[model samples]
Target: MRPFAFERAPDLAAAQRVVALSASSRAETVPAMLLAGGTTLLDLMKLDVLRPERVVDINALAGRFGGVAAEPAGLRLGALARMAQVADDAGVRRDYPVIAESLALAASAQLRNMASLGGNVLQRTRCSYFRDVSHAACNKRNPGSGCAALGGCNRQHAVLGTSDHCIATYPGDFAQALVALDAVVEIEGPQGARRLPFAGLHRLPGDRPDEETVLRPGEIIAGFLVPAGPWARRSRYVKVRDRESYAFAAASAAVALDLDGDRVREARIALGGVATIPWRAREAEAALAGQVLDEAGAERAAAAAFREARTHGDNDHKPELGRRTLVRALLEAARMEI
Candidate 1:
């Protein structure tokens, strides 16, 4: 890892000042990086993928943005709240099982204990080429260079949202839950605080695959707001991987259903591990809007989910795998007694 300076910010204002200083300094190749749990930043740094000149520690700001609370309107999750805290919260477990289950199924207990909700959502892709600095063809790592995954072994890469420049998959479990529930992300920066749809946070790899998010130069994610809904309790997240534990999903689905008798009143669907971004399968949700939860309906919804999925060589099976995963999740959610 490259030598870098580290400093801790006591408050949000101090953090902003540090960011401003870094932005003004032309010495650093990249802007100042934020350090929360160090789960993502440290790993990339050690790999020499991210050689930031300065890292601003934000753990001190937890007291201001690290609480999980249940509000009458919805659930509010502070960005710094640990994954374990949010997953084990009674309110989250009971009210938003998809969110809890997604967190519980991610990483190991040790990582869940250390990683924060905000950091987890912003985690980088797991593409081997992108992580290994030896590969000089990863567009995400070095923009305008090239993408080796497009012609190489890309079984774990994305199929849904991909550009010629990059095909790295969005590798987060919690973001799928947030997208399915239509959660809103709260961000604070030097300009001010703003709320945006969770779906809008991630950007597709158009030309500049390196720019992964819509966050401004100095914006930091503060918290997430998941609105309360009749379908939240009946939600489920199904992750399909080569192995059960400690493996990233090959294809995963977060599904929520509000049923009137045997017919669906409303259905929400989001897919992960097979897309460039947290993919909300709105077409599939629409297919099940008034349909009964039967085999035919499930198949139809699944087909709709992957209707627009584009796959490369090795990942050609992902569309089928993703379809099956979503179908199973929808069926299971339909039977859930919420």
Candidate 2:
């Protein structure tokens, strides 16, 4: 790993000040980077993909930020709360099974114990070209340089939110759950605090693929707020990967449904491992509204979900796999004994 200045931030204000002082126009290229779980940050740094001149340790602030509270109204998850803690919480597992399941299915037990909820959502893509510095072409790592994955081995790349500039998939399970549940993200920055829809946290890989998120420079994700809703109780996340465990998803779906007898009252669907950002399938939800929850309705909703998917050479099967995953998740959620 590259040698850099290290400082432990005593509080949120201190952490913000350090980052804001070194903030640049582009968030990815910021000279000073925050250190939370260090799962993603340190990996990229060791790979030479990220070369921040300074590393600010924010664990000291965890005392004020790390807690999981589940109430009748909603769930409040502190950004610094460890993934394992939240996943194992009785309230989370009982009340928000989708959220708990997503976390439980991610990474290994060790990583889940160390990774923070805030850092987990902000984890970067696992594109080989982006991680391997030897590969000179990756738009996410280098702006306007070009995307090698376009013509190279891209079976793992995205299909739902692909642009000519980039096809790297957002590799997180929790974010999809958040998007499906309409969770709100709390952010603290140099300018002050703000709450944004969790769906709006990630940006599409347009011309500027390097700009992955909408977070302003020097901003720290404070926590997440998931309001209680009918759909929250009957939800599920289905992930299809190359392996059963400790592998990134090839196609995954987070489904939450509120049923009116055998008919659908509301449906919320977010797809992961197939999009540039946490993708909410509004079209799919529309198709299922007021329809009977059955195999035919699930098929129609799945088709609507991937209608806009654009795939390159090796990843042509992604759309179909994504559709099947969504169908399975919806069916499983319908069977939930909520």
Candidate with maximal lDDT: 2
Can you tell me which runs of candidate 2 are displaced by over 4 Å?
A: 25-30
User: What does candidate 2's lDDT look like per residue over 104-185, in tens digits?
Assistant: 9999999999999999999999999999989988888878889999999999989988899999999999999999999999
Worst 10 residues of 2 by lDDT: 21-30
Q: lDDT of all predictions, in order shown? A: 0.91, 0.93
TM-score of each: 0.97, 0.97
Give the C-alpha lDDT of model 1.
0.91
lDDT of 2 at 221: 92
> Once model 2 is optimally superposed onto the true structure by TM-score, how far is the C-alpha of residue 15 displaced, in angstroms?
0.8
